[model samples]
Target: MNSVVTRRNLLKLGLIAGTSLIAPRLFAQAHTNTQEIFITNLHTGETDRVLFYDQGYYLADGLDRLAWLLRDHRRNEVGGMDPKLYHLLFSLQQRYGQQKPIQIISGYRSQATNQWLQKNSDGVAKVSQHTFGQAVDFRIPKVDTQELFDVCCSYRQGGVGRYLSSRFVHIDTAGVRHWG
Candidate 1:
């Protein structure tokens, strides 16, 4: 009887075990659904859907182009925004499905855009998290913007700003308690 241990056998064993370990992760990735957020434009009365996946967030199908129109600064921007905020937005959609789409007046603002906004509007915060891609300005389409502000205040995730004339509520991941 002759028996020889070879590299081929070891390779085959490693391949089988590695595939077994990664199979579940591949399955989960295939099964996961995009996070859904609905934005309602207060002035236009238009509702739109936005989807967020694991990648650097891209505009989802059926999303209002106006809501995500900040100037691109992807190359020079920070990206560690907490996923919890996206989940919170999804929860809001679930809780208020019947209402008009919650309008994303602003999301993921670029530093240049934030600077321009700060220069133009007294309402814009000097140290806004929007510049860091960690805040959003939103409102409910056809619903009173104040109602949206009230809803955001209930969550207590971060900063909440009520801008009545601007017709939007701002939510951030700053972990500070504020409303204006």
Candidate 2:
């Protein structure tokens, strides 16, 4: 009996060897690069330092805790917030290269709260994305509000509201729009 080696066999072996050598590095990098979001809800006086994404997977429990933290304080309503909002905040934190907790002025407003705001405040929209769990009004401590708004605008991922007088920026997963 005789044994034979073919070019295809060598190629397959090379690929297998290469993957074996590279797979661990890829896995390590993915796990090491965890995505975190630090948030402080001003209304509720609650804070969270969440590791929401790691190893190419999102932690649902972390996200749920985030939603609870961002719940409507007045009505005690918790909306199922869009996960992208957390990712957006994470990206914003990365852009700033600062881990300071984002001060949340508003998040997950209930319909009644939104309607009340709309009726009372000229700035509030009758049909605000806040009522849909897709919006957040936030500020980063020690970061210029305008700079934060500019960075969020650069992403062009959604609407950006610069509330200079209020000293916060509002971001939403809605059609791109800007307002004071």
Candidate 3:
């Protein structure tokens, strides 16, 4: 039996082999580009590892869960957290070159909570960004607080507060300002 080896068949074979070889690499690249956040809320003992951004779109469900996770524990109120804040956190993770879960010391703060803290604490701001869901106090496990603070400061995107004693770094999506 003589089978004619046609150019079209050869081209099809080459294309199939090329696609087979390239598909996995493309998938891996997409996986790597996916922006994920792993967080543990210290106050509520809630944890989430979410792929919030894939390709170029932010997942609404992931954002919703993140907002719930970051809710004010005192009043159990969920605020509309700024998406930029999440992006900032994602950027921090990328900058650190690690996928460690960020331990959230604080996230959204209710007006009552903020007011009470301001009245009771010496360093708490009267008009805190946390009340507006624009700030987060967090620390990545095994990452130095100073190093994290430095990384945040380098971004110059917003506020970066270093509470060395507390072993946490405060980040915000407000105007550039910093405090200890």
C-alpha lDDT of all candidate models, in order: 0.64, 0.87, 0.87
lDDT of 2 at 68: 92
- Model 1 misplacement above 4 A: 1-34, 40-81
Candidate 3 on 42-88: residue-level lDDT in tens? Answer: 88888888778787678999889999998999999999899888888
Which stretches of model 3 miss by more than 4 angstroms? Answer: 1-32, 97-99
lDDT of 2 by residue, 77-108 (tens): 99989887988999888777656888999999
**TM-score of every candidate relative to the true structure:** 0.58, 0.79, 0.78
How many steric overlaps does candidate 2 have? 0
TM-score of 1: 0.58
Give, for candidate 1, the lowest lDDT window spanning 10 residues. 62-71
lDDT of 3 at 28: 70
* Model 1 lDDT per residue over 49-121, tens place: 6566533344443233433432123323334444556666776777677355666666666667677888987
Query: How would you order the candidates by lDDT, starting with the best?
Result: 2, 3, 1
Runs of candidate 2 with Cα error greater than 4 angstroms are 1-33
